[model samples]
Target: MASASLKAPPLPFLRAIAWLRDGMYALHRRMVPGHIALLELATAGYLSQATCAAAELGIADALAEGPRQPADLAAAVGANEDALRRLMRLLISAGVFAQRRDGAYELTGMSQALCSDAPVTLRDLLLFFGADLHRKHWTHLSGSVRSGGSLWPELEGMEFFEFADKHPEAGEIFDRAMTSVSSLSNEPLQAAFDFGRFGSIVDVGGGRGSLLVDILQRHPSMRGTVFDLPRVREGLEEELRMPGLTGRLTFEPGSFFDSVPKGADAYLLKHILHDWSDEDAERILRTIRAAMESEARLLIIEMVMPQHHRPHPGKIIDLEMLIQTPGGRERTQTEFGNLLSRSGFVLTGVTATAAPDCVIEAHPAW
Candidate 1:
């Protein structure tokens, strides 16, 4: 079976492609009638909703075996035949699925990613994005923008983590979505950094230990621990059972705000600091710093937002943090350096990974 992996070109080549893609977009905007282009932009939300609907209805899964007539697909997924046909037609226009002359629909490359068994399935991520709670959060985007804060606390009467704790189903979907995202970054991380240098590593706030498992599997001699909340331990049994990890990988249950596991050769914080404000991020960092030996390294994996106005995924994700989490935002390299200094660590080096995230290395300053 195929596994999710990153096969990106070198960074310079990728940047060149990005520049070309941006130029094409600009040229299209100039060539198309202004009103028509603006209309398409305005209607973009419709496409998002339609794609979410397709994922929710399992349209891609039903067609996984082969092409199927619209009526047959509707029956398989328990949807209205005419409505399913219309939805499939919209998706076809968007290049998600295709229809044959015989009136049967088949998966396009885009739709195939929605299949549960795909090499890099995005179905869980789509479902989480389209979940009712997420939609509600986005509806309050204006409030967050105006206040320069998240609306999650105001709407849910608690912080995002607490809300997740109380709602098991929502939490499960979020965890699954995060794991899917981790899969996308796994190979890129292995290629970008030297995890083998550390004899032992601890993944702070590492839900279910997905990244750590991938790393330990790559470096057979390296030992790894996943430190997360007690609830996250529920999923550890399955990962622990993965072949060749019987003794090399383990999970430790706790909160980073309190403390992290001590004295590992390296401490990895992947996508963890982005969930907090500078002050709170420092608290978590200080806690980790206190637990670390002077020689130990700290590895923070996150998107380093570009200082300029170039297009980056982190720019959009920063908005998501604004609406979803209190005092959370993606940081620039300088911002990261300042934050590490404040937390008693010196920014050492940064390695750009093939994925959107970059590996930032730091050491205790004092």
Candidate 2:
């Protein structure tokens, strides 16, 4: 029986087969590390979608107090117990949640961001991005890329702002998201720039007065105005009620395309110019120019697009502009200089902040 088994294969033949198997195993070992990274990258969209689902279900809010079993959580949120358990497993692995030894889940620091009462809650922001309309429009991103135009008009039968105006719920979420994002940028701006030098500053297109309110609070000597369309200016009374903001910060309702309030030493265009085409941006700039004195400064607070070799948040946001706005885009230094010159201002300097955004200073061309 031992001789019969030994005769099954020649020694050289068996060695050749073993060698081939070893070579294949070696190739697999080498390829697996790279393949794992690529797989994670390729499947990243699923993670985002899952996160949106969790936010929509208010899982963070449910887990606010303590850990809970998957069944209890599913019952609380009206989700499928098994499916929610699976989702929680993935989330726990992703660092959004933590799994306990007892098979319950708890909120981690990352999941705290989705809690409704968190200082800077991003729940609404997640919901807004994962909303049906936004997701539907994103499906046409390829169309936008090919046409060099946005899918906003085609998707909603109007511009994004028009759509938001028509939908109060979406508008509220969008406004809240903007406020959350702006609040994050406000501190870096306060640290980087000296707003105390300007007697008065007008925040053109300031929505809900968050940034202006923050600025006025930071600079006791500076009085500020928050200017935007009537719809955007609505409900800002609550925002203006901050302790020292009574007489310091005020609202000015109007359109940037038409006119911005005059007589302010500095006009602030925070995250504004990136929302329109060159023609529209120039028109808005001209309106500000008409309202400004030769010595008045234009402080544009936005992300300065960097060179293409490295990664930048502005570059990703520029693609967002392409998806939502007709010709809106983040600009490089040269682009900013050109736009400022055409709009009757000189690009004086760009001050970097701890945040990715910068304070681009310009003076009216005398």
Highest lDDT model number: 1
For each candidate in the order shown, give its overall lDDT on alpha carbons: 0.89, 0.83
Per-residue lDDT of candidate 2, residues 31-53 (tens digit):
78988867867888788888989
Candidate 2 CA-lDDT value: 0.83
RMSD of each: 1.6, 15.2
Shift of residue 358 alpha carbon in model 2, Å: 1.2
Model 2 misplacement above 4 A: 1-38
Distance from true location, Cα of 177 in model 1, Å: 1.2
Worst 10 residues of 1 by lDDT: 1-10
Any idea what lDDT model 1 has? Answer: 0.89
Model 2 quality (TM-score): 0.86
For model 2, the run of ten residues with the poorest summed lDDT: 1-10
